[model samples]
Target: METATPFKLLLVDDDPQILLGLEKIISSHFSGDEILIFSCKNGLMASQLLASEPINAVITDIKMPLFSGIDLLKFMNEQNLACSSIVLSGYDDFNLVKNAMRLGASDYLLKPVDEGLLINALYELKKQSGQLPSFTRQTYSLTSILKMQQLLEGLIGSSDISLPDADDFEQEHHISGQTSCLMCYVDIRRALYSNYLTMFQFLTDRVESFLNSSREIPLLNPTVVYGRLDTYWIFLLFTDEASFEPEKILEPFLALLTKDHFKYSFTTAWYPYAHIRQADEECRKGFEKYYFDLPYAPSDAPANWQTLSESLDAAAAAAAAYDYASTIKNLELCFAMFNFLSPSISDVRKEMHHFVYSILNRNSAFIPIISTSKFTDYDLFEHIEKSESLSVLKKHLYSSVNYLIGELIESMENKDDYVIQKAKEYIHNNYQDNLTLNDVATHVFLSENYFSTLFSQKTGTTFRNYLRSFRIEKAKELLTTTNLRIYEVAQQTGYNEHSHFVRAFKAITGQSPGDYRQMKK
Candidate 1:
């Protein structure tokens, strides 16, 4: 096996400060390695460097002035530079990141980038270049998350888990808990699933800032950021009394969210778990209501035309975010708004027709509730009016909208399945080469992280594990049939180092290659 060339990294950002900050953070991780790091203010300079220098990877910002990151990505593709790219994206720039992903960006890191994340991206690019992976802060973060989630979830039984002693809780939880605690779970509406880390940090800062300024509200201790899953934030609030109601914290939180004008709709609920014995009950019983109970109060009286229209519009926007939960929840709010009007069955039916039509306009291809041409006529409304009761009308409307959600999910699934299958085919046809996950992900036009996740979801095995299994299987067939040295067999099956191949083979097969070969003979 040959040692790989030293890694060369190109950093491009319109902001000089950002470029310097990112380079300083990333370079610290590779101080002992033979790696070259270069920084430029725009993509044009990065492009020039790409043409003249041996750059193994690039970290570029998306919204540069003269030569944007997207433009640079396009140039890289057209000229086939083959450098792995990591796009620096903002929350609003997700659409652009999607386009960049399709244009072969290896992965993306969000703006106000975390130091660990930058190092992790560079370390990952290094691995894809056939170099040994190094320990990175990103690695530590991921490892810590796994350990924390495991310990926290394990401390409580599936049935019981809310309260532990303050001393033990503070020690085990890694933070101080208020004598009275409110555990608030917040789910952001319309946040991209891939932006988990950024969302976590953003929510953390937002909540902390609000807590800091709002002292008038009876809060004993500062808000503590609890652990997070992919897109949700779990926060804990402390109060002076053990019998404190969670709504005290939740109400103020909601008020602050409204005041701040957050773009995403959020569902927030807090559980009171101050009593040690009731901890399990609070967590287990309240979880259902927390997730499914209507976040907004139900209405019976007539809602104004403006309010109904606004609710419907909000639901439509939720659909665009691909937030099916929020869409349905908003639709439920809309239905409540409609029923509050105490309008005639005919009036409700009329409004339903308009609402459904609005939703279908965006998803007409996925939901076939009506023909595109038929949307102009009143025939669909007449059919809907035939429903005998409000109960029946609500059921009909719910099922239909659910079908739309199902269709939307399925449409995306089909496209994802096609991409994963293509990737699998590519891996199969080229298993003998020194292939990297980035190469396959790049070939299939997906960000490496997304490709890995989608592939695992579809196949129930990770890309690396799947590739290793395939390669080892190929090596087995060759060892049995052909007169080849073990090292040659290892190379043909994509292992660059003989010892690494032997270790992997034994791990998978429970036998050395030589022993397996002798047994076959």
Candidate 2:
């Protein structure tokens, strides 16, 4: 491969992890001789590098502690450095993105950047800087997750994985004569299948992209595989660079993940590389110790966490029973415990999200009502993640729960009203025939007992009384309008016996049919 024309790129961010991540990706793409990359923790340091070094391009963040990315752009503009500038910012910083564009930034990208876009932008910048040669796009493709999973599991069971592709896999992904390896396992507390799928793919892609471009590990492509539920395992075979810190490389990418998906609690443990099986055992042991026996939990942590956990369960139970007040109270208690304990923000969000999941699982009918036609679970989860304090999280939680409960109650009332209206229509049309509470209830698709109680509650009268009153009114109309005899009138009004009909008419109107007909006529 011909050596590409020497190009210089400067990456600027206040975060060291950000700088490290960018450097690794860029270096993986261009050799040290082909593209020289410089990094700094702040805009001031970046400005110093630009002054001393003949930098051809610069990618900078918009916000920093003291001197912002905007200030760095101003310095570049004033100095008239012939450098291609690109700015990065969060979506909230759109105004700053525009300001960067106004200040002669050639392009801008949102934070949690798409690596493909970054690569393309760099390519364009390289072309503009007069690249006269070519570089190799050397990469390792993880063709099958299933195959990789089988190979790793096989390696765990025995000393050597005796698969047909073992030799080719070693040649493609492993460093030759590697004495040591670095292994990292990441676990995210996302319960839903859809959510875990997204998080897993995201972390996998980022690690793969970086490793694919990395030149140090030519012997082995890092092994990236799905571990147990909601976790990922990554193994890198590196040359004897004992000074190399894997945390420095991995932390930045994790930081990027948290920036975008703060609602999820992500835990990672590092292990010394031996063989695949040994490394797996070490990673699991370390992860369990780090996750379950965390130092942040004080001596009183068990009491507090247990209380919060119990409160979450209680809240879910209350919600399932449609006890809105109890559900809200228990939910508030959980948040209060979180406030007192002051657990990690990520853990708090994850637990609260799980509480919501529990409630929905128990009462799935409310799930659609909660998420659809309003602020969805995804939208509310974002709010929970971005909340600055426990109180803010409580506020968002209360809002979502309130909306869900309110809609549920209102829907129940509407359903009752509809059923009653249908029952009334059925009664009015069929009063001349024999009517029963069971018949009306069946017509409206409700149990007979429930319909009977609902009718009384809605109409302020028992079903039998309402039916009798309807029949009497029809009989009165017939006694006055038609010359029907008392017996004929009783038959027309759904009464089989004349004496019974006359007695009911007198009880209701204080007049027998004979006298009432005479008075009306």
Candidate 3:
């Protein structure tokens, strides 16, 4: 007798209350041990759980923040994850429900969900659970594509490390010796919303599914390698038993990718298979021709790109130091280099994003204010992407830089004023003590020299003068309010010597202490 498979159901909604209620309703129908229940507040969480766990079904809301239920369904479809989906939608989201269905959602329920209908859907999903494919999450030692590329490049550069034979990879893909091979390079312009790894995985699965199902070519699975700049290098190996043209496969593959016309633009280059590493090198050179080298690419493009990167780095450092002039100068230099290079539009957008991200990351004070002012990192990148030309991007960058610098200056001033106010309060409360600038500066966590300069800037008076004037004001108040002896008043007002107090008081009020007392009376 075969063991029964444990049914795992995931409930996804942005509403905590809805998730709890759904869990309760599902729990009432099935025992906890027999049917495992999981809950998440967004589609992102659901996708993660579905990827790692054996989730039999997902009950996800059609709309949510960050990642929508439709996006989750698409992710499952893209990853070829074997889980049934039942989407929850509002009455107005019929179109979204239709999209979810198209993306392999088994069923859907309207909001204020009917418990009976949900139970029915679960029962149907449970019956078909055994048919769902088992999934093992692919593990990677390093998740970042850039890091992986760097590591591979380093290994390739090292004298001791040896590159693997082409036959080795071909044998791993189950193709024998001297097999015909075609290397396909697919470059997609990365979207602002998706991370590189997720995009790469989706493309990989989509390509594998398409190529694996082809009937014309006696094909082994393609050896997929992640490449630089949102590109994939796929090596398709064919058995010696077949005679097929590479274009037959390449043309349809390109067509399949071009279907995502809005989110991605496809640039593909194919070549006869050579050494694995050499194939990548050739593909990169070919891709550079298509992706980076534009009609306007001049002879000095490499030098210009180098200068642009260095200038952006200098600008980031200048921004961190709050040197607005140097920051602007370096940024203008970057723009000049960038325009002179006249790289591809994608390169322009990508470089500007790095420029903005670098500056903001270095000067973190600009991040929150810029974010609150509706110029978030996402918005910034979107603006750069949408710019028709370098001039438009330059204008946007300058406007944003100016706004952030203004905010940074105002923020510094306000903070300094606050610290100065605190210092004033401390002096007012402890004026009778012999408080020096060092003592008060330490209390406020600032160096004495900096505090002195800031005090003068914010209060419009020197620290020593401000203290003397404050003490004198206190003394004059006491001279009229209480008839204490002059020496006693001096002692109470942060002054040790009576003669010095009298001199300071005359300097400020233009009268001797005794005369000031009489004048006030």
TM agreement with the true structure for every prediction: 0.32, 0.33, 0.33
Q: What's the CA error at residue 396 for candidate 3, in Å? A: 13
> After superposing candidate 2, which stretches have Cα over 4 Å from the reference?
1-136, 139-162, 167-179, 186-233, 238-278, 281-314, 321-521
lDDT of 1 by residue, 59-149 (tens): 8999999999999999899889979999998644768999999999978877667564566456657878877664332222555655544
For every model in order, what is the number of clashing pairs? 0, 7, 0
**Model 2: per-residue Cα lDDT over 1-521, one tens digit each:** 86555788889998888888888877767788878888888999999988998999999999997888999999999999999899987645768888998998888766655564566567767877777435443333345555655655543435464565545555565534444455555544321222233334545655656555554533323454333222444444334343445555455555654443322222133333344456665554453222222223223334477878998998987775556688887876676566556666668778877887787787786777756735554245666655545544565566666666667767775778757756876787688787788999999899999989999999999999898898999998998899888899899888988888988899889999899999987
Q: How far is 158's C-alpha from truth in model 2 (Å)? A: 12
| Candidate 1 residue spans exceeding 4 A from truth | 1-4, 133-521
Judged by lDDT against the true structure, how good is candidate 2?
Answer: 0.67
lDDT of 3 at 336: 66
Give the clashing residue pairs of candidate 1, or none: none
Worst 10 residues of 3 by lDDT: 261-270
- In model 1, the worst 10-residue window by lDDT is 286-295
Ranking by TM-score: 2, 3, 1
- Which scores greater on lDDT, model 1 or model 2? 2
